[model samples]
Target: MLSGLDPSGGAGIQADIQAITSLGCHPLPVLTCLTVQDTRNVYGASPVDAELIRQQLECVADDSTIHAIKTGALGNAGIVDVVVEFIRKRPDVPVITDPVIKAAGGGDLADDALITAMKERLFPLAEMITPNGEELVILGGDADADRAAQNLMDRGCGSVLATGGHGTGVHIVNRLYNHAPDPMQWEIERIGGEYHGTGCTLAAAIAAGRATGLSARAAIAQAQNYVHRAILHALAVGKGQPVPDRGIQWER
Candidate 1:
């Protein structure tokens, strides 16, 4: 379940829903914050109280057999704490976390302390944590992606998928590192334009794959393909950036 809802239909729960549905899995969304924004940027955001989030999570968990979860844009420490609590109960379920530090238009999504809270509390529980280069710098305190991912792994995350969008390169290379045999790497032809909610789409696709019982390596591979296809057909909803068309099917 995601931590926020974006009304723009580009990111947050909207994006999650689209990605998960495209993968043929049911999405169980639990909103922890409400964001006011268009495709351009986040104008304002307010988090739901921890108790309310807890109630929503409890209700969902009780009513349905949740297969997997994808989390994005948790607004604060209180929300992180509550989410961590909920995740702790479902130790067997796979959890993919898209660490949302800033918006596509550079708006702050979480404070420094909130980031710390996530590193300490939530990172350990994640089956995979997808962070862009900028977010890795903040959380891993290292400029090198490999070193940064290692730092996160030491802290407890099962794997780190460091996306190459924020880096300077001719090709976007996403690296998956952890306790696996070796790191899995995917190099894709870099799309020319900036796309909003790509990370959210990737994480949700991974979650859907995991929910359907794909192994970690297979899930990551499938998710990368889905994300690339979505971005290739991204929708230009606003002036700032294109939003991923998560419904696009990757036909062979």
Candidate 2:
């Protein structure tokens, strides 16, 4: 299940649906926020009612054996509280949370209270939290990824995958930090050009990989590879940034 729903199919739940299905699992979408935007910028947003969200989650949970949960762009504190309570009931399910605090086009996705709630309430329940360099700074309450990730881990999160896409460099490094002695890292040649939905795609792929029985570490690696390929074949659908071609032909 995914929380944010993008009408443009550029990111959020639509991206999650595509990525999850591409990885050979069914996508059970649950919308926590509604985004009004194209591929370029996020113009506005409105969160779905918390009670309505509860009903949707309960309905899905009752009918399906959900293997993994992916969350993104939770718009407000109300939604965060609702999700935290809901996930508390299913401690066995793996949760991959893409901490979407801002849009790729520089729009605010969450308020201060929501961010605080995520760190205080949501992080502890996550199997892994994926945050880009910028978001890591906010979540970690520090300037660097290493320090920020460590801060979050100390706050009870199971693990942190600090994405390096937002940083300037020849290669993009995605680092994974968990209970192990050392954090694992994957360095990929930077793909030229801006693309929408990469974070959503990566998180959903990780969830699908986990749902299909890959171990957490293996799932992270596989998901990274999948996102790379998707970006490699990304499409210039809108006038703004290109969108990752999640429908690019591939075998699972």
Give the per-residue lDDT digits (tens) of candidate 2, residues 77-176.
9988889998999899899999998888898899889999999999999999999988999899899677899999999999999988767788889999
TM-scores of all candidate predictions against the true structure: 0.95, 0.97
The number of the candidate with the highest lDDT is 2
The list of candidate 1 runs beyond 4 A from truth reads 180-182, 250-252
Error of 1 at 104 (Å): 2.0
Residue pairs in steric clash, candidate 2? none
Root mean square deviation (Cα) for candidate 1? 1.5
- lDDT for each candidate structure: 0.87, 0.89
lDDT minimum window of 10 residues, candidate 2: 1-10
Predicted candidate 1 versus true structure: per-residue lDDT over 103-210, tens digit per residue: 878888898888999999999999999999899888898987778888899999889998886566678898999867677888988888668888888888899999
**Model 2 / residue 201 / CA error / Å:** 0.5
